[model samples]
Target: MTTSALSAPPLHSSAHDDNVPNGEDQAQRAAELAALHRAADAGEEAAAWVRQLAGRQGEEEHGRLLERVAEAIVKASSREIIPGSDGLLTEELRYTLAADVVLGASHTTGTLPELHPGERMPLIAVCSIAATLPSCVLGDLVREVEVLAAEMEAATDAGRAAELPAAG
Candidate 1:
């Protein structure tokens, strides 16, 4: 019974009839959870990356965002929407912005312009929403939405990663 073995991080051990051959369940469980915690903490780093990218949207971007928010609000509260209703206004903005970010990141911009509403109007509509929201809320909202987009991309990447085989 060496001290190093006792103090060492436990290996992946479990009584699931899969990996564990002989080990204390307590140590196994603790190690599994610790690994999970580390992954969770790594996610915070991913979130920070998102926030940093979002925060750099710049003044011209903010102004454009504010104008979009305003127009979006008016169109949303309007009695008669010509082609699209304001009912899904906010969601549309989030989705469209997310889509734009995705497309821009992937460099597939000219392929698709609309993320929601099934049309190319979201780009036009989002600029409307940014115009409607208050100044303080607008930039934060932009950050929030951009962060959401990045999260979406991260999730997709994670999903793709999950399907990969374990390291040798």
Candidate 2:
């Protein structure tokens, strides 16, 4: 997708004049634009990689999840950096999310008991793939996965309790 599609709106509206001089304001705006462009480029490249990986693995659902995670990371990071910025570019978000999903799946799969030899190979591959992502993105993914795992564990425990015989 085009960079424009992935890019967030300008951080500051020109309509509201700031205290800074005209030239200075223009320069600041230019810098912000440049940063946005860089972010968009990075996001697009990540997204393309995710798509290729998903296609190779024949895991459309995992791909979609990873893309969403990537998008969330970009959006959150962009907002943190640019006060008035709308968020990550659409394309960037898509790619980021795809990668995040794959990472999360790999993490979950790795934690399970291996039913067959080499079952953990995908997890190893995913870790290598995750190494390519920014630390901030990985941090966010870990937090998300932790929350999900906790919820799943709670549900499983509840199910097990339900299966127990009634107390005498």
Candidate 3:
């Protein structure tokens, strides 16, 4: 691809008037997406990796959890698209939500127990995957965060509480 297709010069990045996707960034984003997909879907192998990453488990269940979380995240992300407004992009993108969930929430408060020979290691590669990318994919990422926030909540008022249902 031509250089022009890759970037609009650094000066233009602040100007969102153009709706075109950056070729270079797109390529990078694609690769990042693939890596996240792999990291999440590696299943038990991922679990063991998470344990080591979290300092919770050993090397045995890494692949397993990796696969589960990655696969789940992908499924969750790919399921929806935030209806664009006036045909312009915004923070409703999954990438944004993902980055917040994995990097912000999981990294902050997800360390837990039972990584012996077989256990869940507070795996959040999918979240990390989302967290690492740009904020363009937030709609997909939001679902994950919402789910996690729901799970981590204690009693009725702790953690990120779920939104109340809309009134008719």
Candidate 4:
């Protein structure tokens, strides 16, 4: 599939305005456009990889998910959620695993998982399973996170949740 189909429509036009005094604005806009295009291309690449891994009657849903995730990662790359740290381009996903399995509604939480930069294969596998299987991918992820939280005191079970939703 084309990269344009995978990426989002630009929020603003990159056309140059004559009224603008300097070329600074146009230059910045050009840079942003370039970055966005690159990200879109990357997302497409990732989606293709996911589809190839899934095979013949591929996991179409998960392939699309990767496309969206890649695009979002490119946009949010600058925010630095884990300040001063460089790793997976991660952000809180859309699916909510648990609202309040044990705690009251007020204490509801999630398990936010990070996609390390070097660990794309595992993620692709997880997403593929999520897309094809009629199972709660988020639940499994939450359980894994709970285990990690136990091993590493720094991790929190109730606070962070990763949203790896099935292909709908």
Report every candidate's CA lDDT.
Answer: 0.36, 0.40, 0.36, 0.32
Give the CA lDDT, 0 to 100, for residue 5 in model 4: 40
Report the Cα lDDT for residue 24, model 2.
71
Q: What lDDT does model 2 reach?
A: 0.40
Instruction: Please write out the lDDT profile of model 1 over residues 33-133, one tens digit for every residue.
Output: 44333333433343333333334444434333334433333333232111122323356654433424423323422332112222223333333333232
Please, what are the lDDT tens digits per residue for candidate 3 over residues 64-159?
Answer: 343444443443333321223232223343343243322323343454333332222133333443333222244443344334333322211211
| Candidate scoring better on lDDT of 2 and 3 | 2
Provide the TM-score for each candidate, comma-separated.
0.27, 0.38, 0.22, 0.30
Error of 1 at 166 (Å): 35
> Which candidate, 2 or 4, has the higher TM-score?
2
Model 1 ranges off by over 4 Å: 1-23, 59-101, 104-168
In terms of TM-score, which candidate is stronger, 2 or 3? 2
* Ten contiguous residues minimizing lDDT sum, candidate 3: 153-162
Q: State which candidate has the highest TM-score.
A: 2
Best by lDDT: 2
Looking at candidate 1, the ten consecutive residues that score lowest on lDDT are: 76-85
| Alpha-carbon shift of residue 57 in model 1 (angstroms) | 1.2
Worst 10 residues of 2 by lDDT: 111-120
Candidate 3 vs. true structure, TM-score: 0.22
* Candidate with better TM-score, 3 vs 4: 4
